[model samples]
Each structure stands twice: as C-alpha cells, then as structure tokens.
Target: MATTTLGVKLDDPTRERLKAAAQSIDRTPHWLIKQAIFNYLEKLESGATLLELDGSAARDNEDRGELAEDAGLQCFLDFAESIQPQSVLRAAITSAYRRPEQEVVPMLLEQARLTAPVAEATNKMAAAIAEKLRNQKSAGGRAGIVQGLLQEFSLSSQEGVALMCLAEALLRIPDKGTRDALIRDKISNGNWQPHLGNSPSLFVNAATWGLLLTGKLVATHNEAGLTSSLSRIIGRSGEPMIRKGVDMAMRLMGEQFVTGETIGEALANASRFEAKGFRYSYDMLGEAALTEHDAQKYLASYEQAIHSIGKASHGRGIYEGPGISIKLSALHPRYSRAQYERVMEELYPRLLSLTLLAKQYDIGLNIDAEEADRLELSLDLLERLCFEPQLTGWNGIGFVIQAYQKRCPYVIDYVIDLARRSRHRLMIRLVKGAYWDSEIKRAQVEGLEGYPVYTRKVYTDVSYIACARKLLAAPEVIYPQFATHNAHTLAAIYQIAGQNYYPGQYEFQCLHGMGEPLYEQVVGKVADGKLNRPCRVYAPVGTHETLLAYLVRRLLENGANTSFVNRIADHSISIQELVADPVSQIERMATQEGGFGLPHPRIPLPRDLYGAERANSSGIDMANEHRLGSLSSALLATAHNDWKAAPMLGCPAGA
Candidate 1:
C-alpha cells in the first residue's frame, strides 16, 4: 500500500484528548491521528477548509448527475404532475419546503416508514431482473429470460427495470470495448432472441444478450455443449464482425442524445429553447485537459460559445446573461487540492479571461460542478474571480453546488457571504448532485469516515430544500436556481415562494430535454392556467462520444430503483408512499442506532470558530495579503525542522 508521512504538533492536553477519543472508539491514538490527517488532507486537497469541511452534524455525505435522460423522465414527471396528487404527498413536500425556521428536526423518518418497504421491494425486483439477465446468459440462449422474470415479478416491473437497466448493465462491466460489444449484441442480436424476452432498453437488452453470447460461460454443463462450441468457434474468428456490430450499435444508441458536434448546431438548438419560456446554459462537453495544449483549445471553444450566446441574448434582461457553464478541471490538468496554490495561480488568468469574455458578452458564466473532491479548489477560484477587479461588476458569474453534499449549506453560506462582501450578486445554482456511486466507492477505497453525500434519496431532497430555503431567504446576496425534475420538489418551491412570488426571485431549472411536461406546467401553458416560476433548462451541447459520461450519469441517477423518478414512474406505487414527508422519515430512522444520518457531533462546528466573520463566507476568503503573508511568514519560519519552530494553525507542543 502507498502512503504519505503526516506530522502533527499537539500540546499535552490535545494529545490526551486525541488519546481519549481514540480509546472511546476502541482505536489507537495513532490510528485516530492518521484518520484525522487523512480527512484533513482530503479537505485541503479537495479545496475544503476549516470553515468548509469542519466538524458539523451535516459535514459528510453529498452527491452529483447528466444529459439525455429525458424520454422516460418526461413520461414519469408528466404522470406525477398531472395526476391528482396524494394529499399526504402534497402536505409532506409543502410542509417540508415551506416550513418555518423554528419548525425543524426529524426529516424523512416518516417518509422512510411509508416508502422504505416499497423501495426495498422495488430494488429487489430490479436486482432480480439484473440477475435474470445474468442467469439467462449463463443458460446460453435461454428463450424465457425476460418473459420468465416479468411473469415471476409481474408486469408492473417495467418501471423497475426500464431506462435504469442500461446504466446498470454498463456499470457492471468497466471495460469500454466489452461494454460496447455487450450493448451491440443487445440492440441487434438480442432483438433476434424471442425467448430472451424484451430488456429495459434496446441497449440494455443488447447488453444482456451480449453477456450470454460474447464471453465463454465459466461453467461446463452438458446442456450447453453445442452452444458453447459454437460460441468458441465464432469468438476465435469473429473479431472483424464483432467490431462492426459494436460500432453499429453505438451509432444507433447515439441518436437519442448528441444534439450536435459543432457550436453552430448547438446555437441553432439554443435558439429554439429561447422561443420557449426556458433559458439555456450551453455546455460544450469534454473531460479535463490532460495537457496545457488541450486546456487552451477548450478555453477557445468556451470563448466562441460565449460570443455566439452573447450576440443572441444581448437585448434580454440586464441581469440575465446567456448561460454558459464550464468545468475548471477541463481548463487545467492540475485542478486538484494537492496542487492548491499552483492551481489557483494558473486558473486565475484562464478564468479571468473567460469571465472577461462572459462580461464582454454580458453572458452568465457558471463553473459546472464536478467531483466532490474538486469542489474546494473550484470554489476558491470562483471566490477569487468574484473578487477580481476586472469582473467585479458582473453578477452573471456563478457556479453549481450539489445539495446532496453534507457540506452544501456551509458552502452556500460561504458563497452568500463572498457575494455580499464582493459587491456582486453571485448566482447560486443548486443541484441534487450526480456522482453518488463513484463518490461512495472512492471514499470506501480510501477508507474515509463516511460518505460525502446523503445515501438516501429523500435525505438529498431534504438537503435541497434546506439549501433552497437559505438561498430564497437571501435573494439580495444570492439568486437561487433550483434544478430538479421531481414534481413534489417543484410544488414545494411554489408553496415556499407563496403568493408573493416573482418569476425571477427564484427560478426553477431542469435538464434541457428532461421534464418537458413539468416545464409546461411550471410555465402555466397547461389547461388549468396556473403560471409557475421562471425556469431555466440545463442543456449540454456536444457530440455523443464526448457526452457519453454525462449521458451515463443521467442513466445511473434516474434508473436506480431508489431513484425518485423511477419510484413515481412505478404506477403501482401509491402517492402516499411517493410523497412521504422527510421529517417523519427521520423520526422513524431515529429508533435505530446509526440509522438516521444526522450526527449529534461531539465537536463544535468549524464555522463557530470564525464567529461573525463566518457570515457570507467571508471567513473562508484568502485574498487578504496581510493575513496570507502572516500565515506564509509563519510557515516559512517553520520551513525546516518544523519551520524553525514558528507557528502554523495548531500551536507548538507547549504553546
């Protein structure tokens, strides 16, 4: 195992406390210290700070998401929003989102009571479908796989297995070529199998069939001899044919997504969105820059996109710039916490250049949210950009924050303060996060204290509302943009805004193609004629190849059995279960040890340390030369042999 050396300077009393805490947890002081260091380093590396990732009840757990997840999501939202809402469901979301500040504590415990069983059953059903695919593959051309599973699980299982299975299948195997082969087989050859039955998606079906047909099954059964021999014979000689099949499948799969590969195509699409009530944030999709050359190329593409959007949107609301979001990771290879100062120094010019371009075009430029670890540094860059003299006048500058994170509220608080002090109204777009599975897996691999996001979907929903409340309440310092496809969440926002709502006070956002039905209702184009809030559509503009990760994330997010979209789509699931109040869910969770995610943290919140300075996130700002220099001097003094015994954060052994 690889490891880094960590040094600590603790006073006798502090060491004693560490020892006691370790003892209480039945761990060695060394173990405790290392754990603390690991967390501390992760925070620093991920751009979290003492005030950002410090001790708090909500200090852990967060999540992130993608594009082209519309068709099924649109269908589900249309049903839920139009259906006579279960009164309980309405009351639950309304009460939760619209509740007063004092009416707090206990979240989702009741919802858990009501929906936990159904959710579990739904998961079991989905898992069984996946297993059936596995079994049918093992059985080699078993004709009854899909039909048999559906009969056993029943017909309503479509929602359980639907669009989610494609992602689940893709997620099962990490190898791109193997996955491609699997997908190809499902779409083309799987269609040929009558007994294999229909799969969730053509892609998913193709993946299932590919599993059975492509690889050699591990077992040697007499029942499989003829088929197995054919498989080996074909496998050895079918390389050229297999590649052609995979390529064809991928092409067909690309049809639903991949709006256009070029900016001109994206711009044409954006014009259509503008015709609707929806505002567009055009994203040119690609990964982080592996080389400085790639970073320059990306920066140029962003500038061009901004120019086009600015030209088109110039005459609109002065405050509303054409929305164009970019990823900082895509701008630099060293966009990590470990690189810290170097990233800040390098990013400053690039961001300043981009922000300048946006300002020039009067376009809203937001930093797209990436993995949780990248957040801290991203925020640092944004904070600095907000303060930069060149773009100080532009409030169109903003970034996304995933509410699924335990640290979201704090991050919001930080931004709100930064916005206040910086003399620019920072635009805050709150999302429910997208990268849950990967984030969780990464944490486990690293053996961190807990997941960085809410494990339960409802918990993330709760966090979304809480953060929304803060943003709505502070409209002067920040503009709140709530992005979701859930009808309940949409209703909550409506109630929270009350009768005094303005279209722009707080806006709603959904992925461009997703929630088409929901947006219509929100804009009051529906027959009932209740005009909802102003909504923005989060759309990605890129070719299919570059947009694959984004598309896959959308699938994983919405396809999971526990997913809100999937649950409501399951028609057999009652409204009562779908909209169970989170407050009650927490109450039910409290009955069990380690059940409710909320922590009665033993340590004080890090924000408390900064007292009044913590307000509006000014406490976390580091642009102050005096403060930075003092800290730098201290660290430099301790440069060798612990910086010549000069102080840095924690004090000397004796103080």
Candidate 2:
C-alpha cells in the first residue's frame, strides 16, 4: 500500500509528551502516529466521539502493537498487573463477611443518617406511593397468581411450602418417571380441597382444583377394592394428564416471572414498556455452568442476545435504552477464587470479548452479583475490564453491589476510586440482595465465625440506603441504579437523590413482572403520581427449563410474609406500618433492646445452632480465597517435617 503525506503541527511541549508516551512502551513516534490515525478512523467508523480519542486511546493502539511485537514475558507481566488490584479488593471483601451484626449496624446507621425533617418527607412521599400502588386497578382487579398463592398458602403453612417446592423443582426434573413421582409426592401430600375457592385468582383456583383432583386420584393408588382399581386405572392412563396439568401450571408461573423464552421474544415484549418511558436490563437466566459445554452454550446465548438487543436499541445509547446483564459463572465452569488462575487465563479473555462487543454497540453490559464468596473475584474481572485500554472511555460497563453484604459500603468506595482511575463512568446497580437464606445456612453449616450477610432484614435495608448515599454522592464517577420494589426504600432513595433530575443523573430499577405496577406510579413526565425519574426493568429472559433457580429465588423473595411485594397486596397491613423507615426501625430496636443494633434475637450464631444439645462440627469454606490461601501456606510450611514409626516388639520385654 502507498501512503500519502499528512502534516500536523504540535507545540514543543505537546511533541515532547507524545514522544515520551510512545517511548515509555518502546515505540517510535512515527509508528505511534500512524497507528493513532488508523485507530481514530476506526473509532469514528464505530461512532466514537472526538473526546474518546484522548491519550488513552492512542496508548491503546500502541499497546496492541506492542503485544503483537513482543508476545512473551512483557505481555504476561502486563496481564498480571492489570488484575493485581484484587489485592486491595480482596482484603475489603474478606473483611465484609461475618462481621458482628451489632458493629456493622452502627456503621451503616452513621452512613445512612438522615435528619428528622428528611425522614418525615421520605415517609410522606413513600406513604403516597404505597397508597396509590394499593388503590390502582390491577389488570383483572385481582392479585397475581403468585401473590394469590402466597396469600392463601403462606410459607408457614405446609401446603404453601409444598407448592413452592413443586414450582421450583418441577421444570428441572428430566425423566418422566421422576416427574410423575414428584407430581404425586408434592400434590398428594398437600390438602388442596379446602383452598379450591379461597383464592380469587382464576389461575390460582384453577391450579387448586387441578391439585385437589390429582391428589385424590394418586392418594388411593395403594388402597383396597374399587378405589384401588380406579386409582390404578387413573395412575396408568390419567398420570399423563396429571403430568400435563402440572407442567402447564409450572409454565404459567414461569411465564409470569420470565419475560420470554428467548432474547428476540424478550425484546419484542419489552417494546410496550419502552414506549411507556421505562428502560430495561435484560438478564439471560441460567445457573452456574458445571461443565465447559454448559459454559459455551450460555456464552453463545449471551452473545446472540447482545447482537439482537443492540440492533433493537437503534442507537438509543446506554442510559436511554436496553442493555444485557451477564452472570460471570455462566461463562466459566470453575468461577471460584480457588480456581483463580484458570479464571484469569480463561474467563478474562471471554469477558473482554463481551465488553468489547457491548462497547462497539454503545450498550451497557452489567455483571450480575452472585454468592458472597465470588464478590472479590468479580471485582478482579471488573477491575481488569475497566482498566482495559480498548474499553477505557466506554461508560457502558456496569457492576452490581449487594448491600446486604457487610462490605458493600467499602466496595462502593473502591469502585468509585476505580472509575476515577479508569477515567470513565461505571454503572452501579444497588440491590438489597438475593441468596440470604443460603448464605445464612452455609455459614451455619461451615461453623463460620459470622454470617456474610445481615441477620435482620431491616439491617439490610439500612445498608441499602447507606450504600445508595455513597453511590449518589459520587455522580461524576458512578451512575447509580437503585433496584428495589419497596415503596419506603424507593421513596427514601428518591428523596435522597433530590428534586433536580437530569435525563441520566440516576435511576430506579425493578424486576420484570413484579415491579411494573409499583413503578407505573413513578416513571413518566412530572405529575401528581409520577416522580418523573427513570426506572429500568430487570427482565429475565429464558425458557422454563432454565428458569428453575431464578423462579425459586423470586418465590423465596416475594413469597416471604415480610417481603414488601407480599405485603403491598394485603389490606390488613396499615399504610403507616407498610411505609415505615428502616433507619427508624433500627433506631427503635436499638433503644428498646438496650443493645445497639443487635442481630435478630431469633437467629442464633452458628456455634449456638443446636441450643446446647451438640456442637456443630466445623467445615472448611472452600469458596473463601483467603481461607484457602492460608490453609495452603500452613500445610506447605510443615511439609519439610517427617516422622517415622517403629515396631514395639522390644517394648514389652524392656518394660
């Protein structure tokens, strides 16, 4: 190829700076300039702004050339250093787990401190929102199937527990033999006849009638005489009908929770909500991959979803349009800290590819938060992604922080610092958290010193508000996404965010089916009911087969008697009690108990799990990197010592 001469003038200082930046990485100024021009044109073609063509962009081009030229020790060193910030982040994350609830609560209170006047304003706003949500006409003037089921078969009741277990596990069972048995076991055990007409939901009542009849038919399978003969006939022929009914019921519940069975369908379903001024962050639902094939399958699904979603966006940009939320575990079989080297070598490259694709389309890609142990590992990936020269100026990179974790406030501080260092804004989604039950049980089983999450729900709420304050205060470096369905939490965040709102200063987030009604009162042009703030719908898109884990989490979250979504539909819960402040609740608890921010009285420490009958045996936390590292070091330290055993034949004679 022939090159044409292009002349550009620069001041002496500017020339020196360019030459120094080029020399730092051992490259000629001429070569750097040519690469920069090529990069600049490529960026322009890809729709990047002039501001994006800063020093970092030029360096990015040079770095690529360097890697190509010397693909040896220097490249390895660079990769190592890029992810080395895990040292700082790991310390922060490790410290978060198992902190004394009493200690953690006070810190959160101080961080979430609100004046009496501000509290009052928050209460008023939250109460108004709650009242409207209650009074608004539901689509059919009745509760949703899930809500109706929860109202009728509460978790405290055996029937409710049975239904939830069946709903959560039915779709994942593969063999027809097992499916039939599960249907028989779950349905036949629950007393469904009395609940037939108790629920006003046609869906719920229909489900009840099916369960009642199926139970009666399966119950007499081993009885004597006519009932037994009739049961045998029904069991042989009508079993398929029972299976079909259960399958339909599961699919119906799945449809209400999941947006669609695929990305294309999800986007089409999202259009109506988009038209109503609501944005979306689509989550492709699947659990952690247990095999490489599983990981690759999920990876392909995410890649396809990104392409389809990007096309659908039509250049609405990151903040204004839809985006994708990815689970890191879904892209790698072993995404644990113990497999740190494997993850860095394998998972990081895949993550970089996805981030680059999202950047090319000018869309956001958020890494969804998972279990407590993976927090720092995720930050390691996120830190590497942020500092990546190719992704340097892209503001579409997103992360999630679970406020229920004790380390949430500290994580916010670290993330803000990182965004400032990377010279780009990061989208941070603040959520109360999922996996609370599992986290608590895991700690108890392991005999860990303390719970990684809060023992009390109110403590988590306080932490959410406190974390929100931290995110809000750093406007330039962070774009805060508050994901919650609680009117009180929403109102407190709304007030704390203040009255003056720009297009993308900050926004609220809600789940797909559950949050729409509540947010309908908040997201539009300024009006009596609307708060005029943007709210993004976190929609899960997947077939019923992949929706098992997601559905279970949603049920556990909303089906709980104390959950905001569960209570919002119950008229017996007064507006005053419904919209009570978490901060105030904590303060009152502290005062009344005379123990400052004590843990829930009902929840015992892992050591005290058995109430003095027998001590719980200790188990290792294989997920905690710090613990694993310490154990490895200790074992290695004693490797040099040896002991020899000898026969004791002479001992008896000598004695």
Which parts of model 1 have CA positions greater than 4 angstroms off? 1-224, 227-257, 318-321, 525-530, 592-595, 598-655
Per-residue lDDT for 126-228 in model 2, tens only? Answer: 9998898888765552226656766777776678788788887778788888888887787788888778787667878887887787787777666675466
- Candidate topping TM-score: 2
What TM-score would each prediction reach against the true structure? 0.62, 0.83
What would the per-residue lDDT of candidate 1 be over residues 360-470, giving only the tens digit for each residue?
767778889988777656766876788788876777887899977766766776787778879888878899998877865655454333455665666777777667777
- What candidate 2 gets wrong by more than 4 Å, as runs, is 1-90, 141-143, 193-196, 225-229, 236-238, 622-629, 644-655
User: Which residue pairs clash within candidate 2?
Assistant: none
Displacement of the residue 646 alpha carbon in candidate 2, Å: 8.1
Overall local distance difference test of candidate 2:
0.83
